[model samples]
Target: MRISDSMRLDAIVRQQGHLKEQYANASRVAATGAKIGAPGDNPVGAAQSVRLQGALDRIDAFRESIKTPKGDLDQAEGALATAGDLFARAGEIALQGANGSLSATDRASLASEVDALKTQLVDAANTKGQAGYLFGGTSTATAAMDAAGNFLGNAADRTAEIAPGVSAITSVSGALAFSASGGRNVAADLDALRTALISNNPAAIAATVSTLDASRRQILAARTDAGLKSNRLDTADAAHQQTQLSLAAQRHAVSDADPTTAYSNLIALQGAVEQAISVARTSLSTMSINKFG
Candidate 1:
């Protein structure tokens, strides 16, 4: 086969171009300190890095969503504890008022104290936190209970996703905490006890003692539930942190390049390109001399 000088020159050009491209790739990797600058470099690793980054972002989002609700639930548990104490105190006062030996004036004074306790209980039910009223269920934008001790919130349980396919309830039920369904309304019970005390109705006061005890038990139960939810959130948060750490490590492994190795590779490619250029120049000079002679 006869080879023309033009063909030899074209082959030299092509070889030089390929060498330059290799040197450029190594330089880019070294300068940028990345093993995979583009998807074409390591297609599988690039795709995996993208997926890991997306998972990490989702975990961050879930953490952000859980923050306010966790605080709100904590406040709800605290409020329920306060409410329980108030109900217990009310029960004590009811027992004292039930005594026949106590004078009517003493009973009236006790009734006044009970009214104050009722007000405090109302405040507990209306407790607000980061997301507004903690016990307001899904109606967290407003107070959970009114001054009259009437539950202003609905029956919806607020929830948040802590992980994939796992949800945690983040709101307390005001109705259950204040006035247990099919049971006595704690606020109304306090009112009845006060009215009974003022009227010196011993039987009604005795009845209210049992009702107050029931209300206290209900509040305790709700508080227990709140505590469990808070624990779930804590567990989920820890797991989320672990997941984020894992995703971060995977992404680093997939995309991050060792600077030392990259620099070494770059130096080797530079040397090879320099050698190829020298050899190409020598060959071209020989060809030119032969063609002219």
Candidate 2:
């Protein structure tokens, strides 16, 4: 078979072009440190990476949502603890006021202390958190109680999305925590206790002990609920972190280039291009000699 000089030269040019393309692709992979720069590089792996990234993005959002609710629950638990202590002190005063040895003057002095405790308890009930009042349910823009011991907040519970298709309650209802909805009106019970002490009524003072106990229990139960919700947020965050790590690893496997392998391939392709150029130079020189000699 006879081959023309033009055909031989054309074949050499095509071979060099192909080698240059391979070298450019290797250079891009080395520079970017990515195995799949485009979907065409690895369609299956690219699709899998997209799904994993979507899952990671959702987990990130869930984690961010968990933060606000966690802060609110912590503040709620602290406020409830303070309320519990105030009730315990009020209980002590009730016990002392009920004693027969105590005079009216002594009971009056006790009543003054109870008044202070009532003010403190009200302040605790109106505690604010990251969003707003912790016990105000969904009505977080206002105080949960008024100075006159009336409940101003609603009974609706606030919630937060902790994971995909999963949510957790993040608020304690002020109406349930401090009003008769939970068995007794906590502030009203304090008011009654203070009134009994001021009037030096032993029987009335004695009657308040059980109601005070019930109010304390209600606050305790609310605190427990807040604690449980906080734990749920923590668990969800941990799961998100774990899933993120797993998804990131999977994404890396499908999309990232190994540094060692990429650099090695790039070096090999570079050498191949250089060798192709040298071969073309030698071949063209020989062809020119044959054609002109």
Candidate 3:
């Protein structure tokens, strides 16, 4: 049962090295406030933190995507409201023109107002939003309606992804909102009313009263659709906000060190390191004495 000085020295050196490594790691955790600086420190927690961060990033992207579409829907809604008001006034003009008692001069003057309303409705149909034309369907770069009351846009619906698997319609179809595609051609109806008033035709003017009402209803329906899309965007954004907050909390739990616990560990490791160095030195001194004697 012989004990060697070299063997004792080697064991002391190994023990000191291990204590120094632990002290270094604790110091980094305390100073940086990160429990998992590298995957080796806590592999499972580091992996979880990565996944949570990816989810947070996706939520942020989805929220950003909602912003432009929501603005487009608001502008579309406002344009439709303006169109509705214009149609209402046109309806009133039609009613007044339908009266047989009105003089020819009076009907001619009412025709002027109908002309103005028709122009305004065209302007509303051609409204541009953040992305492009509001009622142009997917063909948003150009005007939705031309000067002669023809629909310049297609009937396609533009859509955007509001959530992972959820898509929402963001663009309105001018062909449906203002042309015969929905029920009647709104601009043509205005033209008929104006023509009836100018020619002093009692029966034609009376017919426009019903046509104008139908056009107004079409605009109202389009407006309702825009409002519903806006509500869906709001709901999706709220969900994204909640998800981002939850993901952040989870990431913090896995990645961040508790300040108090980190500092306490650092202090404890520092003491252990100092004690290990002292023991190493004492062991080396005793070995030197034994060898020299």
Candidate 4:
């Protein structure tokens, strides 16, 4: 029960050190405007913050993925629309050419237009999307056209993840679209039209027209499919955004400290530390007077 002078001094020093540490901690919190400076302060909150940040980054990446592909699919849809219109026009010309009442000069003039439409259709099929070829699938390093108007694109599958484990297929492979049901391509039909016009064969022109009609239908069907996928992507994106917002809210509630409350508590801590220092100094003075004065 007997306390030595050295023990008394040591106890006073330890108390002062503890008070100083509290003051320093409060000041740091005030300056940094954060209640959780280190993991030791709030281990659970710190861990949750880390997880929330990871989720936010992933959601941002998912958003970017869907955005870029959406634009590319829209472009593909536009190109298909234009190509279909041209094919319909070529069909009209084919019907006109079959009429014997038309003179050779009329056939020549109509053939020129048919050739121009063919070229235009080629340009449309070779359209590029945001990342690569719209109708060329995943590979888009080069133009997707050959001398015979055949598409030389790959058949790669691509999808976008909208949620933690849910992903939607937003893109169609070029091979699937061009090959259609029976491995037929829009360009193949256009080539037939080109041959029919250049050869001035009425029967050939008619056959090409039929094929072109089918090609147009095929393009339309593909476009419809792309549109549906786009819609689904948009829905998924919205849902993902909502989930991200919820995560952010949860993180803020669990980990983020209120500046106003933190500041008030810090001020109180500073006063308490100052009071403890004053009392410790008074005790030291009393000890000095009893021992020496």
Candidate 5:
């Protein structure tokens, strides 16, 4: 079939233009390292990628919540440990004061040590973590205890979302957590011990030993609760991390480019474009100049 010269030249030019466009697109893809730059590149995959990103954001928020709870639990556990030690020491001092062989001077010396422990326990009760008070429950602006070891803070039960369907309390009420099972709090017991020590009365000091023991048990129980919360927080953190990882994988599957495949494809496309340009240039060069010039 005979073809018009102008039509033949136009066909070559169009082919060359198409090849050049492909080369430019491949160059861009390689430079950007993106197989799917926009929704139009892969509609279904892009939609899934967006969904996965949103899910990842939610998982991250959950993970943060779990982390904060764990921090609070850790601080509470530490404070309880200190409180337990203080109570145990108070019991020891009471026992020492109960000894008849000891004089008033000795009992006074024991009182000094107990006084220091009181301060120590008070400071421990004021421990703070990422969110604030460890034993205060929710009020973070002030310490959990007063100078006399009395519970002075409100432990408004605060909720932390560890996962989509799970939540954990991040703090314990200082008053409720520090009181004896059915008796006076640790501070009052220590005060009673101080009074008994002043008189150097074995019977009086001995009577307060039980109160101190009960106070110790309260602190230990609080520690146990904090431990359980810590464990749950760790589990929630791990689960949230897993969910985020899964979402990240989905995002990568949708948008990430395969380096090896993309590189090879780019090289092949560049070669094809170069060849098309060469042919088009040759055809244009051979075009007949029908008039004498």
Candidate 6:
């Protein structure tokens, strides 16, 4: 049971060092509000936190990725709405021009108005949005219609990923919206209306009314499809927000410190460290040069 002074001194030093380390760890946890400062502190929780953080990062990425598509769709909807109004106006002019009482001068004046409407419809069809041409399908780098109101884009719809394993179409098919492929060609119909009025052909002008009606329906249909896609994007966004919140909570639970507990532990560890220091100093003082001699 006889212990050497060197052994007693070594034991005291080791105990003091251990107490100091514990006190430092508690202090850091309290100050930073992090339960695990390093991977070694809580390996399982830290690993889980890393995974949850990755999930949150992916959610944020998806959120950013959908912005362009959303903007394009909104712009496309507005353009389609304008196109519809132009078609309605064209229909009204066509009905007026079909009257037999109107002379060539009046018909010519109406033709000029119809021509202007055709130009406006072309502009609406080739409208540019945040992500380039709103109706350009996959060919968003260029205009969706030519100067003569012909289709320049395809029927291919562009899409965007809004969430994991979920995607939604962001671009409408220009060909389907303003070309013959979509049941009626809006621009061509308007041009025909103009040509019929200029020629003073009652039958042709009357026929233009039905054609313009069909073209109007096509625009309405395209707008409806775009609206449905927008709704889907909204749903995806809502779901993403919920997932992000859940992931944030999960990561915080794994990595965040309990402030109350951390503070109490810091106080207790500080007291233990102070006591260890006091005992070590007292012990060293007792072992003076007189006692050793």
The number of the candidate with the highest TM-score is 2
Q: Rate the local accuracy (lDDT) of all candidates.
A: 0.86, 0.89, 0.89, 0.76, 0.80, 0.87
TM-score, each model?
0.86, 0.95, 0.91, 0.82, 0.85, 0.93
Looking at candidate 1, the ten consecutive residues that score lowest on lDDT are 175-184
Residue-by-residue lDDT tens digits, candidate 2, 1-293: 78888898999999999998888888999999999889998999989989988989999999998899898898888899999889999999999999999999999999999889988988999999988988877888998888887888989988777888887787877777898888889999999999999888999999999999899999888888888888888888998999999989998998899999999999999899889889988888888656775
Q: Lowest-lDDT window of 10 residues in candidate 3?
A: 284-293
lDDT of 5 by residue, 6-37 (tens): 89788987897888787877777788877777
Alpha carbon RMSD to native, model 4? 3.1
Clashing pairs in 2: none
Which ten contiguous residues of candidate 2 have the minimum total lDDT?
284-293
- Predicted candidate 4 versus true structure: per-residue lDDT over 1-293, tens digit per residue: 99777887899888878877887877777777666789999998889888998998888888878888788778877877887788788778888877767776777788888778878877876788777767666668766666556777777757767667887776755665565432567777766766666677777877777777787777777778778877877887897799889988887776667788778878888787788778878877777557774
What is the lDDT for 204 in model 4? 82
Return the TM-score for candidate 2, rounded to 2 decimals. Answer: 0.95
Q: Write the per-residue lDDT of candidate 1 for residues 68-110, one digit (tens) a residue.
A: 8788778888888998999899999999999989899999999
The residue ranges of model 5 lying beyond 4 angstroms of the native Cα positions read 64-68, 180-184, 281-293
| lDDT score, candidate 5, position 25 | 72
Clash pairs, model 3 backbone:
none
Over 38-110, each residue of candidate 6 has an lDDT whose tens digit, in order, gives 9999999989989999889989999888777877787888889899999999999999999999999999999
Positional deviation of residue 261's Cα in model 4 after best superposition, in angstroms: 1.5
Against the true structure, candidate 6 reaches a TM-score of: 0.93
lDDT of 5: 0.80
